[model samples]
Target: MTTAAMPATPADPGAAEAADVTGRLDALDDMLRLGGGRLDPRLLDEAGALLDRAGERLRLSGEHTVVTLAGGTGSGKSTLFNAICGLELSPTGLRRPMTSKAHACVWGLDGAGPLLDWLDVDKRHRYARASALDTARSDTSLQGLVLLDLPDHDSIRAEHRAEADRFVTIADLLVWVVDPQKYADAALHRDYIVPFARYAGVTLIVLNQVDRLQPEEVDDCVADLRRLLQAEGLADPRIVTASAASPDGVLGFREVLVDTVAARRARAQRITTDLDRLAERFAGQSGADEPPAGVPAPARAALVEELTDAAGAPAVAEAMESAYELRAADFVGWPVASLADRLRSDPLRRMRLGELREELRNAFTGPVGAQQGDVDNALAAVAETVTGTLPPPWARAVRAAARRHAGELPEDLGEALKDALPTFNQVPRWWWLIKTWQYFLVLATALCVLWIGLLVAYGVFGAGGDGANGLIGDAGLIPYVAVLAVCTLGMGYLTNLACRNMVALQSANHGERMERHMLDSIERVAEAKVLKPIADELAVYAQFRKDAAALRG
Candidate 1:
């Protein structure tokens, strides 16, 4: 994933190693960001410590390596520390715990002052291995080494043992001292070796006081100790037999230190091992592959549909259709019929749907309706669908994300649906034309009836013998009037039928359109309040798994 070209064969191997370490650290930063709270808190803390230690170590000095000397109380640990430092910096006597605190003997202190401070080594206990005059030529090979002597791990005082444990955790290379008598101490193997088995590469075990044994028996003791260490999960454990009393007793162990220092890789190796163990712990809590892409489409659709029903969309849509039909009839129906319609309540108004948007402004604050359970079930289904394929912890995270904004869902849906409903304020031009024509027909029928009645009145009063014939040029006013009345009324009836048919079609279309808009609104609310959060969490997991796999590698 790095675009920067690295040398096919690096001139300096340390540079390449440094670049590799930087890349790993960067990947670890990503892992911490993506998987921080979702993973176990203890594991997260370990990762954070590793990052901080790596950063501080790299900043202090790459030239110096911090190697800790650790062992049980009678393991000759202080004696070995003095032997390595070539000075009696740590007291060695019959004292129960000779080194109650940590002491540092730093070589090449050119820039190691801050490092010692970072390690919290007391000034009184600090010593210099190489002087300014360069007089200690024999110690030149061990330059750039910051050797630490820690308190006895098996000390009677809990504080002493705790101090030893703390140094062991932060040391770049651990030199464990054990006497022949307590080489197989269970506390040593269980408390330290087995728990830090991943640190085998950066660890060294020194078997002190081998001079107490027969020369021939020393090899047998070393071999047996090696066997025990290997059994405790350290493959090919490094063991050295030495004595603090003999001048040349630790020559072989000193040579191992020389090689470790010349390599200048112990610090990076320690941090890498820490990262590897942490990666393994993370892998245990997650699946090998990434989780599924997201909640399936059908599941999302089902959720939206459920929400639509719970929001009363269907009822509102049906009311919209009935309301449209009633209003259309009032606009285009015959005059007498229009007046009758005014007496009947508007269907939407009767259902209180006209005020629905306003009423819903305060609704769904709690379980206020019969459909609230449906909403809850739908939300649960969405959460399950998103998290079903995830590992337990990650699944829990995803489920939590889904429900984080659940309480706001109802109000969001109400707002969306309120915006979705159409205002039925506009009327079609054809309705006005039909209404005018129906009123015209009604007026013509009324006039025709009046004319027929007036002609009859005149003939009955005997003032005119041919009053009926006088009308419409002798075609007979009665017959003409009768025909005009029937034609007008019949046309009115036919027009009403056509208008009713068109209103029915229009009403059905309006109902279908409203249903679609409401459904769309429900989907938007679902996406904003539910599905988006779930998707965001899945994205986090996907990236976390990637970074974790890189760490494992």
Candidate 2:
């Protein structure tokens, strides 16, 4: 005999939906972690909790769509739950709040046990149309549904209320069973209905125990409930009236469930609702939904200027000017002035030039001081400029990022300045040529003095004895010596004047070169310490905004 294998159970309809939600949540977690302190801590915490719960729910049952029956005390939620399941699955006596711990009724037991376990529902019953005593098959449209009978939302015990809230958060669908008398309860409308308006797609409102009301009164009650739902932001909500005590009262409620199950879209719809809620939470905080414009040009220029001052650019440039002038004097000054220049302290050394040069050659290792204050002020200004158009939360995040970037400013600025020192340390070739001319002028002056002295000595010796008649008297050499001495002195004075002008011109050129180097160094520091951090934050914000938009979609 050939035995036909029973048809394999169909794959869980929600598997693809669950996977998509899981991937989105993982991406969100990564984005939040990268954002770190730059995002609102409270929002981050809320998002993390939601992600964890979603993961747990998805893992437990991608085949079953968990629907919760929630209502206030005396709302007959338990009776309605039993009527819908066609069994005595929930206690419905005079216990004030009939249900305490949640009771679940699984339409098909296969692959649904783990979902019940995750939901913490210890009381569970399995039902299937195929196992019914009647030979004729009943409708099996609700095959993968898990219906929950939850404790009253307004129970006297806080734990009962808390339990109701917990299930409500994770359930794929919610059926609010309100009695006619309590249909317009302020607590129900304000606390549950309005807050869950974003979840309208997965919600159903049933007016249970409507058999207690007159036929004429039922219309008025449902109309009143509809108005309240609309006021709470659920425009044109799905609302029905049923009397679970009556045999046929639950048929209407059952038909809605059958339709819901037939579609097999509750799981995907529920996840989509959750994403919508999250996107709403981040609505205002994400700003204009476009990439942020970076810091303004004026603000950037101002920041550079402030940083330059803080890094001692002005002091370094002035030192360069003085040092150049002094150095030039040493190389090209008159012999007498050269000696004085050597005796004086070196200008660059007196200004701590060696330390500054070393700081630039190495990385950021400069001493921190008053200059840091300027850097701080400039950073604050830039932060304000860059984040000015952002929402308050994002602006605060950007500001915090700016502060963090500025922490390394002082050292970085110092290093930049030091790196620029080599540009100003160069010597001009004209200095050496001027020095050679000055040396010749010195030699001529010395020779003239020697010549005059020897002539005077010969005249004195000749006057005492007859051996030598004075050369000065023989060839009018005394006048010639006098004229030569005067010409040598004049030459020395003129040479000294020319050397002074040359040194001054060289000093001016070196000063201009030093200024350019100093400005360039400051610009580098500004880029590292200010502009780069703002750009990084903008990039992060852009990614976050994109993720938010995807979630919304």
Candidate 3:
């Protein structure tokens, strides 16, 4: 609602206006409840703003009394059009009109393109000396007023017929120009006046070429035209017997233009009415009052859900599980030697412990695990390659969610990966071969360790109780051999532990660092890459809507 200095008194006009504005504002609320796609949602909002502008323009049009000089060929309409422009602006409508004489003259402010366009006029009149007119005459009341010199309304050409239709859309005043002979012609009443019967109050009829009509015939022709106009629904349409060749009704038409339609109050009312129409269109799209700060609640949920589904959560979880298992084996595989070392040493292993879980998840799966710390971390490096890649709104929400839930990585690391996303679990073709080789290495290492152990045991126990033909070659030397063997086996075991544990720890540490970097990368993208730009664009749209509305008002 608007508040002005004039107020307090209930009957004050200013207060009434404020109340009216409040009413329209309240009406806007009802429109936004209906929502759907961007076509219905975003598109509608913009269309509404445009409509508001169109309506405001319409009001500006209303203040000008349009007195079109219309007639058949050689009816002196062009001459009359010139006379009208003698006090108006250039006469553009007659530039190439079929009449071979002058027709309509339009008068208004400089920004008359929209109005002329609405009238389907490719050319229109503008004041060449308007600046001088302002200095020469102090009156500024004619700013929105327009006068037209039209082509023959009865022209055989379809193009001429089209011009008439165009004028009616934008004209607030219509002054029909006819000669004495055709003033009461059936073609005029049936073709033109009858169609605009509903707008009779703004219609005026002019009979040109009255100089040729005898005094009695003039009254008769005027009376016949009046009766015809009445039957066509212009019950009280003004009939002014005019002569462009002489000087009869021209001054009266000019007087009406300056006095009634061009009056300030009339101009303002027209503008206000046009604004009402534009507001109505806008309100229907955006919320009638104020649009919600963002997408509507229902729309927001739908969009987020749609985005999450597209992110492929299941895939990320699978990838994480594989990563965790491989990493864990390396951390604890010292007894089996390579088992622990290989798993722990893999670059993919260390990321989950730090921030690499989400990144790994995302790389192995898809955006589904972007919210997961491991996946987020894993994607950091990948994000750099696609600098401007923007995530859907839902993806941002999911990433934020993953950050909040990142603590779970350490506790439920395996399960988290399994449930995180399905896409991540699908290993590449090369990884399949690698996994097969991992199993083969584990089996081969086990077999070699067992064979070596058996050979040493047989050597120690080979000196049988009989001490003859012994498998290891001597019972008396058994104790000495056993002692030597114990030392060698102990040394081998220690070497194995040190080799696996030390190497595994170094690899895991490096992996963790990489994972942390990956997470940083993904986080930066969720913000700088996607969220910021979308927010900025949406804000611009909102502001545009507001500015358009204010201008219309």
Give the best candidate by lDDT: 1
Candidate 3, 22-111: lDDT as tens digits: 344333322332221322455457545534543444433432444455556556666666664555333334444544222334455555
Question: In model 1, which regions exceed 4 Å deviation?
Answer: 1-13, 131-140, 338-370, 459-469, 472-475
What lDDT tens digits, residue by residue, belong to model 1 across residues 1-553? 1335434534433555666777778778898888777888887888888888887877777788899999988898888889988888999899788788899998788999999999988899999977442354444378788999999898899999888988898898999999989999999999999998779999999999998999888989999998888888997888888898888898888888877876788888887887778777787766866587778899999888888888888887787787777678767777765556557855655455445434443343444432556677887888897676678989889888878876766667766666776665677889999989999999999998887776666645544555444563333467878998999989998899999998999889988998999888788888888888888989888888777777776
Please give me the total number of clashing residue pairs in predicted model 2: 2
- The TM-scores, one per candidate, come to 0.89, 0.84, 0.40
204-263: candidate 2 lDDT, tens digit per residue:
999999899899999999998898899889967999889987888988888788677755
Give the winner by TM-score: 1
Clashing pairs in 1: none
Error of 3 at 226 (Å): 8.6
> Of the pair 1 and 3, which is ahead by TM-score?
1
What's model 3's lDDT at 259?
57
Q: Is candidate 2 or 3 superior in TM-score?
A: 2
